[model samples]
Target: MPPRRCTASAAAGQTGSDSDLDEFIMRCLSCEEQYDMDDAGTCRECYQEANEAEEELRLEIDDLKSKVSFLTLSSPTLNPSTADIVLVPVDDSDAAPIPAHKHVLSCRSPVFNAMLENDMEERRSGTIKISDVSHDTLCAFVNYLYTAEASLDNQMACNLLVLGEKYQVKHLKTYCEKYLIAKMNWNKAIANYAFAYQYNCKQLRSASLAVILDKMDLFTQNEYYAELVDTNPRLVVEIYETYIGKQLNTAGTL
Candidate 1:
């Protein structure tokens, strides 16, 4: 061929074809990814609504954060003098006592409230002896009562959950239970189920039991299973009962 002719023509300075003009590509306002008409995410009105909703949620979250900050008390470690009562860990008596406000404790836990409000020995002595809890656990429990927060690892969460349950601190119990549930896996499932049953934590117990049921084939091989069967045969029976019930339900569904 001698000289090739331009098969596609363009108007004035324009170089793109008619197909490009009609392609209708636009970036998603929410996700900020480019999309064509076929993959269009939302209309302008819906996008604006979504943005407004997101902003409102952000403002609400900020407000809640500020409120939490305002409500949170200063740590007893930082200002021990302001505390009206002291909590001594009976299990770890050598450890330094944990100081706390009576009002704060009373507000957070019914057990504390009853102990402090009435003419109890704890109120008279201005000291409460907490048994079977380590110094670290007592500190964490007191800190959570003050701030409604805790930095939780598995052991710490379990410790605090036990304290929370005994003291009737519902919020702390729920928090720790949720944390344990989030960290639940096959390795921890059996132990967590037993712990949850012991603590009366329904959510955690159910989740852990589900995990255990899913891996029932390996149940007998688990190290903790032998101990659990030896110590709490009733709990093991309950597990078998639950598994049977689930199987029956599944068969019914089928």
Candidate 2:
């Protein structure tokens, strides 16, 4: 009889524990003010907090999704034709590359200023001789060293190559070469060749020579031929003979 009573007591305790758990789940899930299995399960306060947390998490997810989409999208200029070139639109009135920005020569570092001054001194003495690099190009170089912002115009590309060769600035040289290769008109290639040769830029010289050789007939026909011969006589003759002479000989019409 005593054993039977003990089992009955344990069963009663288990029933009470399950009833309490059901009440708690209902209160949290259903947003009820109060819940009881006795009163059909309700607790409003816990439910309201759960709803608020869900809305907060939903907004956070949306924000993260927007960021993900932005990161995945590519720039419009990533097209193959425009990949190597950065075009800056200019008005006829603005003769300079662009308006001066604070980052150009406005560094507060004395070490950087001294370096620029030294560069200027080297340039004046012709000790740091480089073909076609102007004061503006020097300014750009200083800006790049200090701020890591390099702006090379279409016309300045050739100059940058010479500057790179003179100072052994490989990064700047590569930047100019890539841009020149991308936008190489026949005339620009000829001009670049003259500067590159003067500076003993072997890679650029070979590239320029190849461009001229490939378009020898066109160069001979261009008004710039005389100027090119004056600047790089050796290259002019070599490219002319390589392409034009070969064409004439092959045709048996020389």
Candidate 3:
């Protein structure tokens, strides 16, 4: 919730006598009703400017997305003759290596650049092995490397997020974070918070914490709550401590 703010009209009369404050009737831009000046969320000007700024930001994002789309290259795998290396996902059963260009992979991920540019086995054998990820996930990752696009589900998003973090692909990690944040809710709050914290996703962690604070009474009812407590009691303690601290802050404010 936003803090109460007075309109410019209220401040205009502040230079005069204190009694002039009451003469300025508070008007809500949205509801158009008389509200106490001390009980307003925003003035009309601030609200309108915020809306305009949001729209401008949205347009800029769209423009950047368009430029990314324009710059997206056709996968070199489509022309295997042009591909210089293959990616092997060791987690899958006899998974086929996915073809990719070494330069593309190197450009997209610093980890890949280090592996391929140095005198590593991957540089010699022309095959890069990725572990702890299934072939499908690896395929999705490679496709995104080439296309700057991915069709994400919860599982895919989680998998990609891990790979993104490991490989230092900040863009892909942010993309996964946005998906996970959008899908987040009370039922998934605790697990999401734990995952976000582990992955150092500040935005997702804050969003999940907000949800948890809203439904603290229902926290224990979630099945994941017990699992989290059993697996990482420290994290559970941290959450409780955070909640208690916020409660203390609220008490102080009141």
Candidate 4:
């Protein structure tokens, strides 16, 4: 047989068509056998094994997500054994900053029992002196004690805020103040105004005043002066005098 001719064109990378991949696979110097480029690029056996490993990892990830969701919804008291716990590492910076708690203490809370007994006794006597807050309020309070996370919703916070103030839970009171201050819209302001005023929440009152003042023109123009007068006549008078009357006074002075 004649020696096969090898040309510069072949060396300069002209891929022949049995599928370009096949030509490359056949050109491999290691194994003298020609094979499809797709086959040459990957060992089918190894590719299948890698695919199986990826699928297993995906399933493990999905299982972990499901477990996390289950743990989140399961109440600690109801399913104590099924709780998922995670340990977080404290860095040097985190270790260095020791938070100064104004009033953090470990003590048994008798407020719950006392309120319950008082409510029950009132109910039996037919007086019903205590309207009685709900179990959810108590649960939220207890949870706050353990986790210190103020996850109480607005209505729950309103219920608990009264309790916190009554029980002298200064921490809870402060927490309510901070959250309510951030959420000091007109409705909540009106709802909690008496409580805010009674509890001496000066900041809450001030926040409410600021909102009223900012929208004074709108209130006056829209004839909703009732909301203002209802909250504080003195405050309403102040707004009218400062914003409305003052402008009138300024015009007169001019």
Candidate 5:
């Protein structure tokens, strides 16, 4: 908000003595209250403008939310009679197949588009086998494809992000990335950094790196960091390289 207070000292330069009583007071442009200009936050115009913009944004958000609800596909039912294809979790033989429409999958992911359109084994057999994911995670992933919504948590966010990365679902990947970034702390930063780097989640990687750098000592003591060093020494080295660079810049500033 613009400061509510302004002084007539501004007018003194135009025509009055410096010590003049009339020159010492001025009315605020916004509240019309007279105050000294030297004090901080002496006006309220910026606050009013910000409030108006916020209200406009809220109205737009309501419209967008309604459109989303209208466009979202209905949640999958227990019956798969109408479904065109089934997704099988290869790791779980006893797992029930997740029924879905080929068209919806194709529209959502280019990878799925290629698989469904071409003479792939999945197209021939009508069974799309997914690997390294649990039945529950697969169901949640399919649901998000149909309706851009998911009940996310730390593990779920990480699981879905991997699937999203594999399928090249940019929106889902970004969604998961944001969730992970929001949940990240020093304790999880190293693992998140490795995961983000592996998946090419640039924004999440940056956030994780920032957290890790802030607590480098704690990162070195973390068991996950030790495991990461054993499994991917190069990524661990990259962290130190970045940290050293940041240190050098700080020293230069000093």
Candidate 6:
């Protein structure tokens, strides 16, 4: 094939003019879209380098995922007979105890490690009673300790996050925080902000506060807003303080 030319005719329906023909057009190697000089993105060399970097990152992610799969234990629910210890939700007597491995629980949570490793009643009875948690939440918590996975809805995420913080399971706490942050919006913002404050989840608290600041007028009208003020007046005051600080920063910037 003859060497490709940057002719004006190359652009559909455009007649060639000396200036237009002289202007170069190239296909973007990244997006694979054609572009004229003015619309160009990266140089060919940079595009090629970017492609290499992306491939390397993809490979690294795949490697990390594979390692996670290899390290993750099978859910104790699948084979309760093999579990050495059981977790009972104190509030739900009728609920069956959740089966789990002591080693897995110990490895995941320092609280569990101390409870089981030391001369504790939990170790002797082979049963650990978890208070202020539902049977389903206990089951999910134990499953996550083993498999590092959970089927989370908003409520479940909140439940698990509370348990995660109580147990000092940092990874699970971070996971639940990210989920809540991603699901944050105007409707849930106040409630989530209150929950984050109660739980000491700074990241989720900041994100929820940002949402609340954006819709301050509507926030007071939210059903949860009054309940939060009644339940935790201190937290409500903090929200106002944050909003005021943000306004001050904006005024300074302007």
Q: Is candidate 2 or candidate 5 better by lDDT?
A: 5
User: What's the distance in Å from true for residue 90, model 6?
Assistant: 1.3
RMSD in Å for all candidates: 7.1, 21.8, 7.6, 19.2, 4.3, 3.9
Please report the TM-score between candidate 1 and the true structure: 0.85
**TM-score of every model?**
0.85, 0.42, 0.76, 0.41, 0.82, 0.89
Tens digits of per-residue lDDT for model 3 on 1-254? 33245577766747677676565556666667767756759756789998899999999999999998898988766778888899999878688889999999999999999999899999999998888999889989999999978999998999999999999999999999999999998988999989988988898899998999899998889879999999899988988899999999999999
lDDT of 1 at 191: 92
Model 2 Cα shift for residue 220 (angstroms): 1.3
Model 5 per-residue lDDT tens digits across residues 142-195: 999989999999999999999999999999999999999989888888899889
Candidate 4 error regions (>4 Å): 1-131, 186-194, 220-254
Ranked candidates, highest TM-score first: 6, 1, 5, 3, 2, 4
Candidate 2 residue-pair clash tally: 7
Q: Rank by lDDT, descending?
A: 1, 6, 3, 5, 2, 4
For all candidates, what are the clash counts? 0, 7, 0, 1, 9, 0
Q: lDDT per residue, candidate 4, 1-254, as tens digits?
A: 22123455554575555543332334333344555446455444665687889999999999988876554332234443432221111222222111111111123234433433455542243221223545455556545644555576777767667767766676777788778878877545444544577676777767766666666546554344566577667755655566676568879999
- How large an RMSD does model 3 have? 7.6
Q: Best by TM-score, which number?
A: 6
Task: List the global CA lDDT of all models.
Answer: 0.88, 0.55, 0.88, 0.53, 0.87, 0.88
> For residue 185, what is the lDDT in candidate 6?
87
Candidate 1 regions exceeding 4 Å error are 1-27, 32-41
Give the clashing pairs for model 3: none
TM-score of 6: 0.89
